[model samples]
Structure formats: C-alpha cells, structure tokens
Target: MIVSRGTVAFMFEGSQSEVLTEFLVSARSLSEYRAMFALSPRDLAGRDILDCPGGAASFTAEANRVGARAVAVDPIYATSPNVLAEQALVETERAVAWAHHHAERYRWDFYGTLDAQARVRRAAATRFAADVRVAPERYYFGALPSLPFADNSFDLALSSHLLFSYADRLDATFHVKALLELSRVARQVRAYPLLDYLGNPLDELVDRVRKELSTNGITTSLVRVDYEFHHGAHTMLVADRSN
Candidate 1:
C-alpha cells in the first residue's frame, strides 16, 4: 500500500484499521503548493523561498524554473541522490495505496480521481529525483527548530504536511519552536492542513501555538486556501515576522 503525505501511523476516532509507524515521504507539485498556500505569481517572481521537510516534492525545482530561488531542506536529502530517488518512488507508491484505501477521508475535487492524483505525485517524485541529481545544491540537509540559514534569508518559507499533520507525535512546543525558526529565516511562513493525519482538527493546539507566537512577536493568522484533499482541511497557518 502506498502512503501519501499525512497518511502515516495514526488511528482516527473510528476509521482505518491498520497502523503505520513510519513517516511516509510524499511528493507534491508546485501547483499544489500554490493552491495550498494561496501563492500568487508575484510570490514566486524573484523571491527567495525555503521549503522545510520538503520530502520528495518538486516545488523547489519548479519554483526555480519560474524565476524563484527556492531551496528544499530535509534530512532525507542527506541520502545519495540515486538512493533517495529510488526511495521516493517506493514511498510514492505506498502513499497512493494509503490514500486509495482511505478514499472517503479525502475530497477528490482537486485531483478528480485517485489515478490522477497518483500520476501527479509520481511525476513530481520523478522531477524531484532528476533535479536533485542535477542541482544537488538546491536541496539541503536540515530539519526544523534549527536550520543552517542566516536570519531573514528567505522572502517566504513554505512548510506543508508536517506540523499539525503530525500533531500526534509533535507537541505544541515543537510547533511553536519550529514556526519561530522558520520565521527567523524568512519574513513570512505558511503551513498547511491545520489537522492531524486522521483529518481531525487540532484547534486547541493551533490556538495555543498562535498565541505563543504572538507573545514572541510573530503575528499569525488562519487563512483559508483553495486546496482541500484531506476533508475539512482548507486552512493554512500564516506566520509573519514583525518588521
């Protein structure tokens, strides 16, 4: 079975019988990022962007192709390009299988069908694999709460499917610290799907983190975006550093 982003080990209230223990590295395209973050053309033109926990996403490759200087940061990037490329394909398959099994948990409007979604992800993984081999510098080996960039190094930082999506494993403190770290490197930060992998909302955690960010001089707002694969997950958390 394929495991897609946010399809990791977690039991919903009364759905999904199997438990997945590992974090599934999934691939997402640039178009998906645009919709998920409400990113405009201006957001991409001549901007420096950072994608943390980038997984196998083609966002960095595609964004750079269109004038943006985008870099992807993930511990998996430490793996050899050939090995990571192969692993991405295998994980993409697992993600697809997981998504297909829990089809009802997701809204198919954006993808139209499971097959289409699979194709899009597979293509993204392919692009990421090829790009990593050619432009390895664009992919950095780093994790949240501590990145290797200078302060305000990026115009925007995009974090997807890792914060609220893994709330079961990552605590409120981690979220606050990670968001602060992202804000440290970029003027603005956006994280999508303020819900757990089970499609369950983490309202309290979100609220707590937002309040903490406010206390720390980071302004946060909940913004609805055009993307919703996980049902009821139409919002992205936006954090802006105080200028």
Candidate 2:
C-alpha cells in the first residue's frame, strides 16, 4: 500500500495490506531475540531459556528446532489457540488503525511501508500459531513478579514489551518485583526496549531498580544492542546474579 509522507494516497500493485495486517499481529523472531539479548548460538545451546510475555513469536519454537531448551510464559497461552488467533487479528487491526491515525509519530524505516509491515507481522503470527498446534506444552500461562516455576530453574531469562513499555500502567515497584522474579529464576536476566510506548526513556525507573538490585547483590547494566525496531530502543538492561 502507498504509505506517503502526509497521506495514504493509493495502493501498490498487488498490495497485501489486508494480508499483511492479518499476519503482522505481533511477534519478534528468533534473530530479534538473539540481538536484543546479546546471545549467540553457543550461548543458547543446551541452555534452559525463559521467554516472558512471549507473544505470537517463534523464538521458543525455532530455538527448540536447533538445540536450546526454551519455554514461553504469557497469559494468552491460557486461552485456546483458536481464540488467541482471533484476538490477535483484532489487535492487529487496532494497531494498524492507530498507526494510520498517527503516522507521524512512528519511523517506518524498519518496515519500509505499511503494507510490508503487515506482511511481516502476519508471517510471524502464522509461525507461532502453527507451533502451538504441535506443542502447546512449551507455553505456560502466567504473569510476573509471580511466576509458577521454582527458583534457579532457567539458565537465561528474557523479557520484553510488558514491563518498561507500559511504564504508565505499571509503576517502579512492579518493575522491581518482576526483575526479582526473573533474577530468581535464572543466572542471567535480560530485558529490552527499555522505553515507554510513547517513546520516553525509563531512566528513573531503571536507576531505581538498578540500585535496589545492587543492594541485593545483583549486578545490572545498560547494554547497547544491535536492534532498533522502535525509535530510542537501542539498549537493553542486563542483570546477572553476583557470585
């Protein structure tokens, strides 16, 4: 579709705007996961990885195809796959509508145009939906600072979008509790896109959590990552248990 500077003027030849919107529901691929978490294949190999708030992404599914032992935890996993798929479609439409209304706020560099953006998203969602049909056990339904797993259960813990992205909805205490649970489960905990949905840096909250974590003997660092799907989302927060 034609994503112009000021208006959506016309559709491209065989533009898959509707199709793209359907597939681009929500999910970051495995490459994105590796980039955000600063992980190589060797890092994930034979490691028990935890993906918190993993949406319709193929990270766990694809990682398992190689050698990593990965699992996803998200509230949507509690619902039936069919129901989740339907909800994803609705969310995709809503997101597209929001983008259309406020086009200026977003930098469409990563996604060239709106139609391609939808297409890519739809593909990720499709992969996730197929994987769920084969093995739903890889997914667990839960929220955090209160996960169901035992302490020190995972080798690596990764979280995205939910915590810092919704800073307005969740406060500093919530972040602390979430980080505590994440740190409790794994030796290495990494979270990315440490910015609000409206593109605000969460330095104050990050600083608070960092100081509190230091007090508890956990080391925290702000790491620059290679991924920048969102503006100002160039860094990730890494927390490791101190010996």
Candidate 3:
C-alpha cells in the first residue's frame, strides 16, 4: 500500500487504487507509548496525565495501573463500552491490514513482523475494551481544538497520530488551536510523529504550529524519540506553558 498526500493507496496483484478517507483509529500499547514519547518511569509515576484522541489504545489503562492518574478523552468514548470495544476491534483489523499492505513504508525493527504488530494491537484493544467497561470514569468524551477541562488540570498531556498525521484534513489553524488547548489543560504536552499518516514530513506545519504556540505563551520543541514504526517518524513535539 502507498498513500498520496491526501488519499490512501492500495495495490493488489497488479492494480493500484486510492481511497480518500480518515486514518484508522489505532490501538497502541503502553510500551509503544513509552517509546514514542520517551516516557520515563518518573513520567508515569504519581502524575496526572491526559491522552487526547486516545482511540483504542491501552495507554490510559496501563499508565494508571503503573501509578499515573491517566484519563483518555475522545468523542468515541460517548458510546457504550461494548459498542466501543466492537468498533475498536474492527478498526484494529483495518489498521493491521493497512500496515501489512504498506510493509515497506515502515520499520520492522520495533515489531519484527507484521504479525507481531497485529498481536500487540489486538492485545491492547482487548485490554482497552475490558478496562473501559470496568473503569468508565477514566475515559471521557471530547475532541481536539477544545476539551472539557479546567486550566492546569493535568501534569502532562500526550497526543498521538491525530494532529500531524491527518494534516491533509486538519489545517494549520486547527493545529494551532489544538496545541494551545492541550497546553491550556496540562503543564506539559507531548505529541508524536511529526509527519502525516503516509510517512510524509510536515516540517512546515510543525514550524508554523511551534511559532503559533510560542506567541500564545506555549514553548515548543521537537525531540527525538526511540520508537520508529513509521519510517522517519522518530520525533515528537513537546510543548510547555511558559513560566
């Protein structure tokens, strides 16, 4: 599979096709989040954290288990746990298939094989399903550019695969607003993969967003991380409210 700037491309046998659509909601694990954000033990211990557009990921569930007070906010959380679990599994399968199809576009070192990637995602989705059912309060209904939280509500915020990954659909203004909002609720905010879903670099967009953030009393920087499932996606944007 290969995707153009605004559409996903799929090639079967000899024919190639493009589909204009939204990126699949991903189910990343706590381990994956740790690497993607370069999270340290201190980062997850006794700290209040927010995961925006959390999708089907088990980060919130796992983070809380390890001592962090983590909460996930996504519009999809409005649905019942059973329904969201089913949707999570379906989206997980789609994401796995897409990743396998575009095998060449990713780095296999992190997952070893496409099968390993699928297994991790499935497990994460299952954990997310069970956790959301038991601890529904940990998950909230919200979206980007806005959130239902008071100022400095969290010690840190983690956002993944929603901002730059869908730059094709989310514009510069939206990115600026979203970053500012995240900064509003957390003392520190970290967003991973400074590229679109197709592995395309978004240097211009990142720079623009950083400039906008700085003007709003938010300081931003690009930090290299240890994870790189998407080739060249080893950097994360870290934003902090200026003291």
Candidate 4:
C-alpha cells in the first residue's frame, strides 16, 4: 500500500506476519517499550510526519497522539496471496480504528499488560467488524515513485527498521537511493535500523548518511536512542534540506 499526500510516498510491509509482531505490540507504548530511537522529543505532537514501512500503524498511532497529521504508507496495505501471514487491508483499518479510540492506552496507559492490551485489540477488531472487510481510508491504496506530492512537502518523516529489512539489495548504492527518496520529500528525516543486523558500525552508518544527505543538499545529524533490545536502538538521523 502506498500512502501519500502530494509528492511524498511511504512503502510499508504488512503487519499480519510474525516478523513485526513484537514491534507492533511494543509500538502501543512506543516511548516506554522501544525508547531507543533518541531523536529529540519522544512524542511527535503537532508535527507532520510520514511513516514509511508503517507496521501495524505503530508510529503513526503515536504521531496521532501529539496531534500530528500522519500518513501510514506501505506496499502491503491489503495483502498478497503468496504472503498469507501479512496484514490485509481489513487488518490495517481495524488497527487504525483501535489506535484512534484507544489513543491513551497506546500512549501513556499501556503498562506491559499483554493480556489487557490483547483484550482491547480483540474488542476493537470486533467493533470495527474487521473480520468481514475493512473500510478503505482515502489513503489506503496508491501508486509509488510517483509520490503524488510535491518536493520538500513534509515537516518530519520517519522510517523504522525499513532500510535493512525491506531493501532487496543491501548494498551501499541501494541504501543511498533509499535515502535520496526519503530526503526528497521531507524537510527532516529519522530512520530506525537494526544496524547490527547489517554488520555495520553505528559511526560508519552515520558517516554514510551524512555523505548521502550532504550530496542531496541536506544536512544530517545522528542521535542514538537507548532502548532495551541491543539492536533495537536506532540511528536517528535528523536531516534538513539545504535546498
């Protein structure tokens, strides 16, 4: 599913798969559960944010708490017949409704109560009648590369565990292209990565980002979030377009 406003587009993987189960559950209380993305303030209140690779609408949910106009983008908005476990359009809509209704639970009310949260999730699922079919949000289905938006359109954009996990070619060139696309649409960018999974040092990753953003006429700053999962920490890069 590709979600966009004008020139910005976000590509997300679905949430039905177990690959992102832990992250999605943790995202309910993104600050407390996954506090490692140290990028200035924890909350995105009043900011315009782009959430790419939007898993279970996790970050988007948080962005909504702070009154941020958030767009959740992903390729797997509905699902592919081949990927049986991925989130379908119905699932995504259900999650979004739950997030909207239980904003407090996902924000400050969440206290690692797996059972309670699960119960709420289940209830929300029923209320939304997601078991049948999900109602399409205006932004649910869209095309890619053509972001349907103009340049330098967003105030802030974030991509968590997107680069390393979603890229087909894990080479430097691939990363550079991905960064370029991200920088093209946002005034500021922050990305979360499981760096160790890439076998790349944090400093090296920072340097690469700096160089890439610099070439793209964007200045970059890297901040580290202190989270529990060793690899859960993120190399949060704040980028401002020089153009």
Candidate 3, TM-score vs. the true structure? 0.92
Whose TM-score is greatest here?
1
Candidate 4, lDDT over the whole model: 0.47
lDDT of 3 by residue, 1-243 (tens): 111121122322333313326556789999999999999999999999999878889999999999999999987887898888887887777778778777888998888878888999999999998899899999988877789899999999999998898888789999898889899999999999898878999999999999989889988888999999888999999999987
* Model 3, global lDDT: 0.86
Can you rank all candidates by lDDT, best first? 1, 3, 2, 4
Ranking by TM-score: 1, 3, 2, 4
lDDT of 1 by residue, 96-193 (tens): 77788889899998989889999999999999989998999999888788898999999999999888988877898999999999999999999998
Runs in model 3 deviating more than 4 A are 1-20
TM-score of 2: 0.83
Q: lDDT by residue for model 2 over 85-130, one digit each (tens)?
A: 5555555455556555546656667668877766666666667777
Q: In candidate 4, how many Å is residue 102 off?
A: 30
| TM-score of every candidate relative to the true structure | 0.93, 0.83, 0.92, 0.58
Worst 10 residues of 3 by lDDT: 1-10
For model 4, give the 10-residue run with minimal summed lDDT.
18-27
Error of 2 at 50 (Å): 0.8
Off by over 4 Å in 4: 1-36, 39-43, 78-146, 165-168, 194-206, 231-234
lDDT of 3 at 129: 88
The TM-score obtained by model 1 is 0.93
Model 1 residue runs over 4 Å out of place are: 1-18
Q: Clash pairs of candidate 2?
A: 20-118, 20-119, 23-121, 23-122, 24-121, 24-122
User: Which of 1 and 3 is the better model by lDDT?
Assistant: 1
